[model samples]
Target: MPSEGEPHILAEIAERHARIGREQLALLRAIGRLDPEAPWVREGARDLPHLLAMRLGVSEWKARRWVAAARRLPELPGVAEALASGALSLDKVVELTRFATPRDEAGLIRWARHVSVWAIRRRGDLLERAPVREDRRAQRDRRAEWWFLQEERRFGLLAHLPAAEGAALAAAIERWAERVPAVPDEDGELPDLAARRADALVAMAQASLAAEDRADRPTVVVHTRLEPSGGPTPGAELERGPVLHPETARRLSCDARVQVVLEDGHGNALRVSPVRRFPPEWMLRQLRYRDRGCVFPGCGTTAFTVAHHLRHWSRGGPTELDNLALLCSFHHRLVHEDGWRLRRDGDVFAWLRPDGRPYRPGPPPPAPAGPPRPAPADRPRPALAAAAQARCAPGPAP
Candidate 1:
């Protein structure tokens, strides 16, 4: 970037790319028109946004935004001209026209040359509600609520509350937070208001959970498998989520009911007199103990796992432990639907990518701090120079 003559070249390249973007937007506008005109009907897409999303490999919201921007572009000659001349970007055009009127477009476009998207958004009273008339469906789809995941524990919550509900939650949080005096932390300082409110929320949730009986909770399904390969010990699987570490699955198994099925050497189901709908409780327990959890690598989920057959049952695979492995629902689907394969070794499942190459995980992280290994014993302390001292004291150089 600091090289001489680079400025001119970079600017020219940027201009060319921007011009290309302008032309691309124009073409996108043409495609946008066909969307409402039902051009994708034969393509089996449910609607224009669906078609665009599939074709562009983008989210529905993004596809809708681009389509809407394209539909509005014809009416925005000034925006079109500036875009064509590369004076502004498609993003700037979208934000500008999100609220600006034809009379204001010229000045806004000129002003936009100097400001950021957020700055332009803050400049409008109409921008907030402009899309209501232009595209009521898209505007209505946007929710006021928020959702977030706490990744450390793989817990997440989604909230799609309306204005009233949001306000109620806000008020309750504030009230509960104010009810308790801030406890002194290690630094002898009280937590801030936000932290206090967060704590109150957790307390509220715990109180609610405490009101319910544990027996009323739903059952968790865990799958366990022993790998034939000399990998890590057997692992746990969740049917719909990640795999669980073996230790975690074992800990959970202590309190949960279990059912297990055995696959024979071939991977076919063995017939029992009653057709044994579920595996024997004892067998399930043993499976859990042996495999620990889902054996699929890196899944990190312990509950709701399903036992899988390394060889498909329809293909005449046996119905005993040798042919069975534990898998989460997602990876299980990959095998059944996406052509990915998991070959079982002694204790490890060597995963294979759909393209037929082995799927190796990245390098393992460093081990945590633990007891240090023992070293050789220290030598006994040397005898104090007794002999030399004795010789010197005697004044005779022996």
Candidate 2:
């Protein structure tokens, strides 16, 4: 057994190790924010974490986090130096980094040595909640208006709207929110009127844009049902509508049309059609359901994704359900035009490297909670099971 002195020495060493670890992390974070063109700085930033993780054989995520924390060091040079000299704890440096402004960050570090972490957090929150002056607020509003006009110039009318119209729309939305009943204090949760108004405004804008586009375009509704037939049963329900883009309408007119219907809560049809020619819509929907967002694993790019066919479309592969997958534009090109492979297995999808092994991806999110359980499993046993047993038994009282 170790003596008391031995245990004390071990504790001291462990504390020292933790202190060193924190300083190293702060340093790496500082480097990450540095200009990449600065060669010496770049070399240190790049090489340090790689070396640390390589030596420890830790996961890349942990290494990156450590480096990110380190990169904030330049914002708090005194804290960084103290950390390097083993004069301050790592926790203090982390608290200081939250204030990115150099002066504020330095002030935070100096204050941290004398105050509790809770006090620091409270002060930070208070600073964040401080109100802006009227002049500053007006300046900000003007700047936002100017930026909105600039966006209009860059992207044209589709992406831009006049400031007055936008403000009127916003006010109308707020009026709509004011009509919703406020929750009582007992309810413990109340609707955020501001957020509700914003959401309503966004939804209205999207619907308005979609309606406008549909009015100017030709649309053909195609009906689809799963039949006893081996493949999907597709039937056309054509109508004389506005003009559609030739390429888009042509895909619908094709013999190998992939028809699917998506509906709203009221059973009103949302989209009906011949799917995208490249990767069929059925496959894209399946990918969307399975992946929920971008299929790049850790990537959070949830914007529109392109359906990519693993096999080339020109090849013998039909644009059917099995041949399609959803990938963001970046990953789509990476798999098709560039050199990468994607494989699907049941509900799961995987990306593969050129070497033919699975390219490791992040784990899927946890499934949602299921419906409530019944009181007894056998209480409502199927009548069919009892009937079958009776038939198997010898003829009874007869």
Candidate 3:
């Protein structure tokens, strides 16, 4: 809210400027059809150019461009339609109509709708550079492109690779599919190998990105609102992306990112903790060694497990080895969103319902023959041993 007497002049001027410019263009187009350069003796105007120069106070070059745009409108009616509809500007059409003709106007108009003016110029350059006669073999070669559009939440990919390259890609995906097989403690029916490979590919990309030190690396950040008596609205948003549902954001946070950022409602950072959202690698390794698998008793799933908060961060939960447990995505969601809850005692954790009904899984099946014993800790120092022996030695005087 603005304080009393505060003016929103900048916003008001910006809005009005756009409307006036569009209206001027529309009027110019209407007059362009009527033929501006009539040798009218009325009102002592020499001609349309003179009238425009003197009345509108525009330079001859800019006025000429606008006049040319009006003249060329008929030849590129598609671009003209967009201009009239206020979807495109006159300057853009003036430049685009230079490369595009009536024959290509339809396509250019569509491009103008989705792409920027600079992109239109780029396409023009590409078209100019294209060979007049394309090689038949090269034309037949496949292409690869991927897009994830945000508006409709749509994803698309088109791949055109040489046979050997295709085979190598397929083989790589197959190796991971065979290695991972399926997600442990899967909630519903499992997807096929193709789907699993797709997921594995995304996971591989994410892991690589997290390890990358390059600028523009992506991150997941969630903003939660402060308590009722305090500041900003509680909401979650993907960095540089759309607002996300709280549950979806929480699920993504399970990626175990090395950093967690806490923010106020106004999107100001309050604190940053590298080990808050994710435990350090050492802690995760310790967790894996101790928990062995999902702690949901009989569920003993070892693969595709994630560390979950015993006391959720939303309720002021702490992030530590003692406050965390390993569980697969299914069980994790159950513990977080569903009515099920978990109680942890050091390495052990158990699941229960709101009704106090405990669900403990049975003991895990026996391991395959003769697993190697884990290596032991280092030997004690000689001086420490001597001290222990002295403490144990009987005091004869006593």
Residue 208 displacement in candidate 2 (angstroms): 3.1
Superposing every Cα of model 3 onto the true structure, what RMSD results?
33.8
Expressed as tens digits, the lDDT of each residue in 192-232 for candidate 3 is 76688887777667777899765632356555556446754
Against the hidden true structure, what lDDT does model 1 obtain? 0.55
Supply candidate 2's per-residue lDDT for 42.
Answer: 16
TM-scores for candidates 1 onward, in order: 0.41, 0.40, 0.34
The predicted structure with the larger TM-score, 2 or 3, is: 2
Candidate 1 error regions (>4 Å): 1-13, 37-46, 122-398
Candidate scoring better on lDDT of 2 and 3: 3
How many angstroms is residue 343 displaced in model 1 relative to the true structure, after the best TM-score fit?
24
Candidate with the greatest lDDT versus the true structure = 3
lDDT of 1 by residue, 1-398 (tens): 39888998899877655545445455445655674767543333446765555444344455565666677777788887887676876656666666667787898889998997667656653457544464554344433222234466444333334445567988988888887668889999989987898778877777788998555223345544434452333455654447776544433333344333223334333431222222345655666656666565544233555566566443466546777666644455556655667787876778787788887654333332442233333421111112211122111000
lDDT agreement with native, every candidate:
0.55, 0.48, 0.58
Pick out the ten consecutive residues of candidate 3 with the lowest summed lDDT: 389-398
Write one digit per residue (lDDT tens) for candidate 2, span 178-236: 75455545677765766576556566677688887643213335433344443433332
Tell how far residue 10 is off in model 2, in angstroms.
23
